[model samples]
Target: MRRYETIFIASPTLTDEQAEELVKHFEGIIAEQNGELLKTEKWGRKKLAYEVQKFSEGYYTLFDMNAGPTLIAELERRFRNHDSVIKYMSVRMDEQTKAAERQKVRYEREGRRKAQAGIKERSLEEVMG
Candidate 1:
């Protein structure tokens, strides 16, 4: 029951409803396969680094779940054979997920430091005197 994250791009030409349906279809597959879907996110339309099937932008969706290897195989197979899918990537998270979580927290703290760097901090003497 390792955690897995999958991100897939759907064609930009699809209507909003169509895109939702596609996401739901994959979710259904996971449920049917007894995979626990932890999170699903639709990133909306975004520009691609390169053209995919003559489209410059596509809708992105992410799925985070815990499941066996079989579910991943089926998901990839569907993406490969489906016309709507422009690109997809899946990664099995081992202990690497914890490292990523720690990195994310550090990144946020660094961002806050950068944003507030211009502000002066109060010294102990300034507070007491």
Candidate 2:
């Protein structure tokens, strides 16, 4: 298996739930093809650098995984068949970068958990102060 990263832009018109579902759908495809998903990040709605399908904004999602060549081809094929997907790109990840990514994900998850716990234990003013 080779490490790879995929970034896909979906139509901005989709609701939050719809967007989540769309991301999950592609993630499922990767898993079904024996791909191991390392991480998934939702960048939320952002202004596009240029117009695509006449839209100025889009939902951006990133997926990091280890997959085979055939799996990558099928993933791209599905992206082309999905109308809501405005654009998608996939690139192979280097070994050193993949190691760094693993560390980054561990730190991010620990930070998020701490933040959530803090939110439940302190007021906004107390936390900020």
Candidate 3:
């Protein structure tokens, strides 16, 4: 399985319940195809950068998951056939990006440790003086 991120915009004209159902529908597809869904975010209705499918606003949803190429292909095919989906995009998180993220987290953790140690040392120096 490979890390993947997918974002889709749904028609804003849908009722809240309808929108939620639509989200669940796609999430179900991922599970059925053996995909691991790490996160799901429903970023409520927002104005689009430009008109799409004759609509100026849309409900945005994001999916972070791990799945193979066949799963991705099927997911995209579903999106293309779904009328409620105004637009969608899927991206595979490459190995280089994952390594860089790990390195960044490591660096941040080290920096925090150093800062805490410095603070403790400063407080000790003041008390001793």
Candidate 4:
């Protein structure tokens, strides 16, 4: 299994429910192929850097998963055949990117810990003063 990230733009005309359903549909595809989905993020409707299918905005969704190459090919094929999907891109995650992501997550956790500790120390100083 290899880590992959997929970002797809859905038609902006879709309601939130419709967009959620579309996401579920694609996720179902991945699950059926025995893919492990690590994350799914909805970016909401946003202005496109460029127009696609005559639309100036789109609902963006990102998926991170571990799956085989064949699964990715099928997913892309389905997206191509779907009218609601304006554009999509999938990229395999290299080792360096994965390492960077891990490091970033660790740094975020450490930052939060330090912030909480600072708050506690400030409270202590206030009590002493």
lDDT of each: 0.94, 0.94, 0.95, 0.95
* Candidate 2 structure lDDT: 0.94
* Model 1 stretches astray by more than 4 angstroms: 98-129
Question: Which ranges in model 4 have alpha carbons more than 4 Å from their true place?
Answer: 95-129
lDDT per residue for candidate 3 within 11-123, as digits (tens), equals: 99999999999999999999999999999999999999999989999999999999999999999999999999999999988776988999999988887998988844357
Point to the candidate with the largest TM-score: 3
Tens-place lDDT digits, model 4, residues 1-129: 999999999999999999999999999999999999999999999999988989999999999999999999999999999999999999998676888999999988987998988844356768898
Candidate 1 lDDT (Cα, 0 to 1) = 0.94
Clash list (residue pairs), candidate 4: none
Count backbone clashes in candidate 1.
0
Error of 2 at 74 (Å): 0.5
Tell me the TM-score of each prediction against the true structure: 0.74, 0.73, 0.75, 0.74
Question: What C-alpha lDDT, on a 0 to 100 scale, does residue 74 get in candidate 1?
Answer: 95
Taking the tens digit of each residue's C-alpha lDDT, what string does model 1 give over 1-129? 989999999999999999999999999999999999999999999999999889999999999999889999999999999999999999988669789999999988887896788655578999999
User: How far out, in Å, is residue 31 in model 4?
Assistant: 0.2
